[model samples]
Target: MATNDKQPVDPVVRARRQRIRRKRARQSVVFGVLIAAMALAALGAVAIYNGAVSMPFARGFSSTVIPADDPIVPACLVEGKEKPIGYKKVRVRVYNASERRGLAATTAKSLEERGFTILATGNVKTGVQNAKIAYGAKGVGRAYTLAAQIPGVVLQYDARTNAQIDLTVGQGFDGLIPEDEVKLETGVPMNNLPGCQPLAELTPAPAPASAAPTEDATASS
Candidate 1:
């Protein structure tokens, strides 16, 4: 395998070998670059998962998909199960049972401001002792929401009323329930569409006035 001059290694053969080496070097560089890029991508993803960036999770709103195993998920993100509904969607008629001539009109205006759709306002056929919300079979949940925003208003399910709901002002009527005090229940109940857990679920019967606690009594207690 050894020659005196080695035949000068053949010009064409030497050129081919040089080309092969250069090709191999280029391939190696490309492979290395690909590997580095993959590593950087993985690191960036890890950083995001570790709280390096802000997330969109917020209160009273839905969020993007979240991994069940993720520890940073917020408690507010739980499935609301509560359908999206607006107060204007609920139809109601306010009646003045308090013997106040313009009480019905005033109450109607207030309810309208709160997004309730008042079909009509008038005096009650039979004067009520306490403000009450009467609803037909179709709008119990909507009715309950309205009643919640108005303290001391008891809910009564009546199938006869053709409209969605009715509000009757009574002799003991005080005023609209404070927005902060009213807690809207958000969740799908077991009842059918126009049905809801009986009014008792949200509003318990009010304690008799005689048994009411005065500020002085409460302070003493």
Candidate 2:
């Protein structure tokens, strides 16, 4: 009986109400899609930050490689008269080959005082009667430069590929020759040793300061 007073709903109003419902459903679907998209974006950012994913463009870049030592023959090897290579240019690593304690360090200090570039100080198993100046073909002049300092020093050539000279202290090593007694001719070109090898035929040592860890002969811990 109460329902008899109510009018029938308008068709246009019904259609509008249906359209509103459809719009709300579409909005809900769009919001859910947006949330999913945001979550995926966040995951992608995390992956990039963690280095799990890399940008395609970034693969084009790379780190620079250090160039090898230049193939240069010592001037003394090529020319009969060569300008003296200063102690500063000559690199030396001292090794104690005898029972003398701290001999390498003491000898390095002495050489350093005379403006020599002492790379390191350590010990070697090989024994010598007097100090032995070991050198590679690239360090012939450098070896001679060190030989000028130590009295009764002997030269021993090796297959090293660097210009670094090794000064091995021996049992008979007293000290560096007196500064006054060390006579280097002034304004005179240094003469090459007799029967010197062709520097062009030998491999060059690593550049200064780029010596490998395996090449190092550091003091025993």
TM-score of each: 0.46, 0.54
- Runs of candidate 1 with Cα error greater than 4 angstroms are 1-84, 161-163, 185-221
Model 1 lDDT per residue over 1-221, tens place: 96687456888999999999999999999999999999998887787699795445535454533222111111111122334246888887777765555777777788888788988776644446667776654565566567667755556655343536777776566678765665654454322322235333334333222322122221221
TM-score of 2: 0.54
The backbone clash count of each candidate, in order, is 0, 3
lDDT (tens digit, per residue) of candidate 2 on 1-221: 45677789999999999999999999999999999999999998999999999856675454643232222233234455555578898998887766767777888888999899988787776656577776776777778777778876766666677788878777668899987776666556666655555666545444334322222344440
Instruction: Give the clash total for candidate 1.
Output: 0
- Which residue pairs overlap in candidate 2's backbone? 161-204, 161-205, 162-205
- Look at candidate 1 and tell me the lDDT of residue 67: 21
Local lDDT at 129 for model 1: 62
- In order, what is each prediction's RMSD in angstroms? 18.2, 18.4
In order, candidate lDDTs are 0.59, 0.71
Consecutive 10-residue window with the lowest summed lDDT within model 2: 66-75
Best by TM-score: 2
Point out where model 2 deviates above 4 Å.
Answer: 1-76, 194-221
